[model samples]
Target: MKPAINPNKIVVFTGAGISVSSGLEAFRDSDLRSVGQHEQLASPHAWNRRRKEVIEYYNWRRECAGKAQPTPAHLAIARLEQKYEVVVITQNVDDLHERAGSRDVIHLHGELRKVRCCGQHALVSDIGISPQYLGDTCPDGHELRPHVVWFGEQIMHYSETGRHFKTAAKVLVIGTSLQVDPAAKLPKKGRYRAEKLIVNPHFDVADRPYSYRIIHKEADSIVPDIVAAWLEGQRWDYGLGRA
Candidate 1:
C-alpha cells in the first residue's frame, strides 16, 4: 500500500495571476472594457439588461479556458497533495487547478465550467467548458446562467473558506493581488502562528495581521521551487530571501 497522506493542512489561496501563464488573461489585463462601458458585461445589471451579451462574453471566456492548459504553478500546487492535505481557495473561475490534479478546490468567484439554475443556486451542473446559451435551462426549466459570481454578487463558500484559513498549519497565497474584499480578508484570518507566505509579482500587506514572508516574483518563476522546499522539509524563511 502507498503511504497515508499527511493530516496537516495547507490552504492555497490563488487569484488570476496564477493562470496567466497558461495563456489565460488576468481579469485586469483582459479587454473586458471593450465589451461594454465599465465592465457592465460582467455584472448582474448587464445580465438583466443584456442577457445575450453576458452569455456571449462568458462563452468566450469558457472557450479560452478550455484551450489553455494548466501552468507549472498549478501543477506545483497540485503536487502539494503528495505530502499534505491541500485545500485550494481561488478567486479565478477557471478549472485549471482541477485540471492540474488538485482534488479539493473551492472557487470563491464561482466556476466557468459549470452552470446553475436561475431559480435555485443549489442546482449546479458541470458543463465541461461548453458554451451556455440564453435558452438553456435546468431540470426545472429555469434559464441557466454561467455559474460565476458576478460583480456585486456575494462570493461562494465564505464560511467554509474562512474555517480552512483559520485552522491551516500553512497558508500559501499565490498570484493574487489581494485587492478584492471578503476573499482578501482571508489571509488575515489564518492562525497568528501559522506559517504564511505570499508569492506574487505585486502584493502589499497594508496592515494585515498575520506574519507573512512576501516573495516578489512571478508565480511560474518561483512557485515550483517553493513547493520543492516545503516537500523537502524546509520553511520559506530558511534560504529564500525576500525581494
Candidate 2:
C-alpha cells in the first residue's frame, strides 16, 4: 500500500561538504594535482580510454568511504525523522546518509557501493566496500562499471527530485556551495511558502532569486541545533540573518 505524504515533509539537499566531517574530502577540496586531471579521471572518455585507472580510482574511493563514519550533520538530519518526514537529495556518492539512518534518500550522483553492467545499465548490483577489478562482469558477461554519474553523464533522478522540492513544507540545504547545475537550481523550485534554509560555511547568495535563511556555519557545528529546534516545534531562525 502507498503511504500518505506527510504535510511537514522536509527535503534536504546536500553536497560533498556534508561528508567532510566524516573524514571524507570534498571533491573541490581534494588534493588532486590539477582540476583537469580530476575531471578527466571522472569522465566517460577516461572510462573508455583508461579503464584500469578509472577502476582503481573508484576502488580507492570505495575504500575511503568504507573506512569513514557518518558525522554529526548526517546523524542530526536523520533524527529529523522523529517529527517530520525527511527526504534526502544528496549529491554525494557515499552512503553516509543511509549509514546515519535516514530512511528516504535520493542519491543524485549515483552510489559508490554499486556497479552496473556496461552493456545494460539496468543490470546493477551492490559490491559494498569490495573493489571492482578490470575484468569484473555482469551475469550477461558485460564489463561491470562503477555506478557513479561521471562528468558529462546525466545525473540520476532529476524529475523525481524536483517533485519532492515542489511539495516540501521545509527545504534544508546543507553543506553545498550551489555551484553544480540542475541540482543547484532545485532549491528555487520549492513552493514559495515553504521555509527554506541553507547551512553551509562557504555559500554565496550574490544573485539568487529565492529567499533563504542562510546560516554561515559548518554543518557539523550547526545542524544538530537546527534539528533540535525543529523537533521542539520551534523555528530555526533564532536571529540568524537571511539571504
The model with the greatest lDDT is 2
Per-residue C-alpha lDDT of model 2 across residues 32-56, encoded as one tens digit per residue: 6434556779988999899998898
Given candidate 1, what's the lDDT at residue 29? 71
Candidate of highest TM-score: 2
lDDT of each: 0.83, 0.85
Please state every model's RMSD to the true fold in angstroms. Answer: 4.5, 3.3
Query: Tens-digit lDDT track for model 1 on 103-139?
Result: 9999999998998998955599999978888889898
TM-score, prediction 2: 0.92
Q: What is the TM-score of each candidate against the true structure?
A: 0.90, 0.92
Stretches of candidate 2 exceeding 4 Å from the true structure: 1-6, 26-28, 33-37, 238-243
Question: What would you estimate as the lDDT of candidate 2?
Answer: 0.85
